[model samples]
Target chain A: MALTLSPTLSLRKAPSISDEEFRKLRDFIYSKCGIFVDDKRKYLFETRFGPRLNALGAKSFSEYFQILTLSPDKDKELASLFEMVTTNETSLYRDTKQLDGVRASILSKIIKEQRAKGKFELSVWSAGCSSGEEPYTLSILLHEELGPELRKWRIAITGVDLSPAMVAKAKAGVYQEYAFKTTPEDIKKKYFTPVVGGLKVTDSVASLTCFQSMNLNDAAATKRIPKSHLVFCRNVIIYFDEAMKKKVVSSFYDNLLPGGVLILGHSETLHKISAAFKPMMLPGAMAYEKI
Target chain B: MSKVRTEDLKPGLIVSEDVKSPDGRVILPKGGRIEAFHPMLLKGLGVTEVEADSGDDEKLLQAAADYTREFFSYANPDSPVLAELFLYATGLVAQRLATGWVPPTLGERMAQNVEHLSDVLPADEADPEKIVRHETELASFPESSLRLKAELESPKASIGSLTKLIGQDLGLSAKLLKLANSPLYNFAEPVESIQRAVTLIGLREVSTLALGMATINYFQGIPPELVDMKSFWRHSISCGIFAKILSQAMGSGMNPERFFIAGLLHDVGRLIMFKKLPYASTEALLYARENFVPIVAAEAALIGYTHTAVSQYLLASWKFPAMLADLINNHHSPKAAPDPRLAAIIHTADAMSNAVEIGAGRLYVLPDFDDESFALMGLPASGLAKVFADYETQAEQTISAFF
Candidate 1:
């Protein structure tokens, strides 16, 4: 039986991880991913990956890590696990209070300003877009508010993750009603269709967005990417250590065009590392504007 | 150990089992192992496939191509210079023993007489020792060089009736007559022509040595790459030196110098294999690792002969004494050998030289020579150590001139 998780990855039962193999596995990942997750946090990894371990029928954590090392395709599956280990479990318009600020402050300004710009080309990159729900919701919000004008605008909603598996699911572009936790019902009814297994994201949502497997450490490769007018690098940086947070923020700052927008999780900020992004505190919460 | 089945394939190979694609979703239609693997995998990754071949070889040629691919993949493209140095250095040592030096250590009575010329020769005109050392030693002897491969295929003759055949080649005829009269024998001076030399030297010694000498100089034609050509030759010469010194210490009277020469040329087969059949050598190494077989056995199977046999044939054709050539040839097969002295000497010296990182520093796979031979030869461990120490200390200038 699998254990329930609180907006987090979980396994049913913890597998015993020997100190030696754990060190080696940790070292391997640190070398490859540039992420130095402490192996001492046996509880963290075990609790998170237990279900996956049992489900995959791997004898132990070492065996699971060994399987991850088998081939590039298999390694991609591990990368997806790494991405979802902390669970990027945001629902449609999650943190609804902040979503309200996004409507009143950020989105309202962009929609109003685009009329003067003549041809507004908006782009958004939802970094660590696990399972595709967030970007599709953003797509639904844009389509509902902007209508045919949104179609005329060269809009891009790029979702990127290190996990090929999550990226695959993201590309398939389907979700269930559970994904609509903060989404308004009328919006869901208008945007999704009742399908055989789950609610299939409409053709319109899939058409507007592209999902790709990308490593944040490999920023140079994805730097010339979406050329996003807005970025939702929320929740992803929390699991990262300070250095990774600084790095992810710097990459985000480097990628955005001037006079664009950057959003972060409530606890995340650009105060020290990213001085170029000026804070815009609206009624509900804060958003960042590119200088 | 047996050769891994997958690793032995090459182009134009036929296999009994069908191989499936890596995912096992598709079976290659009626396939032999894809012909060449290293090139194939590189190509498969190369093409943004709808699909393609490795252009070097198909995945399955024989059983070994996959192993070959796996080996090259781990091989750094920059090429590890150490491995290159090892091949070159060992080659130089073998080269020097072939023609350059005839050591006091390996000297027979003839060699000993020349070595100790100060005690015996006239000293009024010139220091005979200096003349012997500086002048005669460096003088290149007129010797025929031929591939033992050809000689192995050549017709053999019985000693009693081979004189006519020996009389055909002038150099062979002259060397035989000279050797018959060189006071090397205890018998009366009955030397006249090639036939007399043939009649006296004994069939096994004459034929094998003739083959050994010619074979060595053939290896000399194959140049090796070494930055300090001197050091390279020196290390090989050292292996030879130690082989000789150890042979005497063992009281085997195996003609230490020839054993040294034998030890020096043992790896020449490796060179010949490298130059003539590179993939075969690579496959040999891989199959050895994969199947846990010693690489030599893999080489023997892939090529027609082992390094010992090749070295033997080569030396025999070079007109070396059959005793010396056969000694070297059977160095790895001592118990059955009539002359295990060279085998003991070469095997011990080769191991020591490599152990001390002498010629080719690190071995791909260590040789599985019989250690029991050393005990049977009555050579104590201490005697072996002394020779090894001597080779280690003195191999420098010795290697300089030839390699």
Candidate 2:
């Protein structure tokens, strides 16, 4: 009617997460491969992304998500958004039980089998090593088990992850004391010094572990870590599908030396993916050895 | 309890002055509270970001009380609106607790009071006896399969089913039986059979116990979702506790035990609706937000007839009390209340239950309330504050039994 029609901007209804934006964000995640998003994950998006949308002054997620993909002029914005989304708030020695298993089954077998075979050079790879905790924990295990032999031997503790943000955190070698909650009082005294923000991971433990950004899906990147004597990849692969799990398991198999061990999350089992390894149940955790 | 200072109060608020005159009725007061969010409910409905820390309860209650005062402005006898409202607000509380979810908004409370605001309230010249309807067995009955089943099934069926269905799952069964035999129900030394459970709970209450058993059964097998079964059950038991107290207040003739059962179940349909069509329930909740209708109407529009009707059928099928069925079907519509006294008592208590939450925690900021119907019953809203204090104590004792 070409009559003046001024629109009302807001309604009483709450600003909700849009399904289209949810799917775009979800598909973007699934497209990165090795993941499946279920209904439970819906709230996570709302909690994580909703604030970012409001900050951008976008009325709906559709406008924001479109801006995310189509805004070629906004590449830096895209990268920052991705960095924020993927960063998991976790600490070193996240769960001590699995670390204990690494010490028992993984190190003992490394000593008995690899130790005597003139393969005294034992390499342990900590996958998804957020902020270098797992790799440092690996260093602690080597010091605990191999003792004097730890420094004498070529013990390379390689920490790898996909997130550039996490990789930098790992390289920075700094953490909050809360991050090392499970670190025994003696270990906290030895491995860390309380600083302004949190705790600083000492260079002694820091020197043993090298941090790098490597996507699991990038074959060339993943292949760089060759023949690790022991692999501590606990609690990370839970977000992956069965096929991705098998792929990662096979990758871990390839990365390990013959009879090298693979440690996984407490809730995971390797029986379905690979018959190549036998599960060695430890007192506190479970591990698998290459047959 | 004593009121605290202004500085001790939270920011962002209004207040409703106590407006009830010596003759009893006052218009709506200021500073109304909304409702609580059982955590998952916030996510399901997609409204997580709310006010800071949310503890301004007394301000909210005062607001709700004020809204009531503004709503009627003053009493009008021709207007059964306030009477109907007391009925409806009472209905909402009972239903929400029974369903194990919180009603996101409290438009229902406002609507319950003002739908007939034009109608006059209790007359100053009106005899006190006439104003108070004390007929306990006033609920009507009709020949329907619903009514027949309501009569046949053992009120004890609730206890037996608990033992059977929930018992099949060892953990819950043990918990149910343990609680059933606990001091609350007072089974001399813990009887084993459903008959014993029925006998202990008595015919009047077995239905509610059965519902309790059923709720644990529903939530147990499934993985944890937004519905916190523990908190949900506790809220339902809280409603059950309030219903029991209010039933006693309805004078002697009313079989308050039946009132307790119905009050515990008025919103059982919501659980089924939420479980069956989560998306639909979410939509209905959305509509509830848009229209300011309570959750029941939201449920009815989404799933054709409120859960009250569905629960009525279920109870009827299970052979519960006839009045219990009406209580479920008409719990929210106090004007349609067949047994007005029992209905009013439960209705009032339900509104007050949530209002107390508003008063205690700033979860929902409710307006202050007028006191005519409550005073007629010898229980003003102030008395409700006292009753709630007592309820808080008793609620503690009873919650563990049901949960």
DockQ for the candidate 1 complex? 0.01
lDDT of 2 by residue, B168-226 (tens): 44554455466566534555576675556656655435544444444334334422352
Candidate 2: C-alpha lDDT: 0.53
Give the Cα error of residue B44 in candidate 2, in Å. 37
Query: Can you write out model 1's per-residue Cα lDDT over A1-291, one digit (the tens) per residue?
Result: 011112211112356566786677677665555566553244345545656778888888778887788855686566656653434444565545556678777886776777678857788899888788778878877887788877677788999887777888888877765566456778778888888767788898788899998777676766867677788876566446567767877788877877778887543456555677788875445678888
lDDT of 1 by residue, B260-297 (tens): 55655556545444444333344455434432334565
Proportion of true inter-chain contacts also present in candidate 2: 0.00
The Cα RMSD of model 1 versus the native structure comes to: 31.5
Q: In model 2 chain B, where is the ten-residue run with the lowest total lDDT?
A: B113-122
* Cα RMSDs, all models: 31.5, 19.3
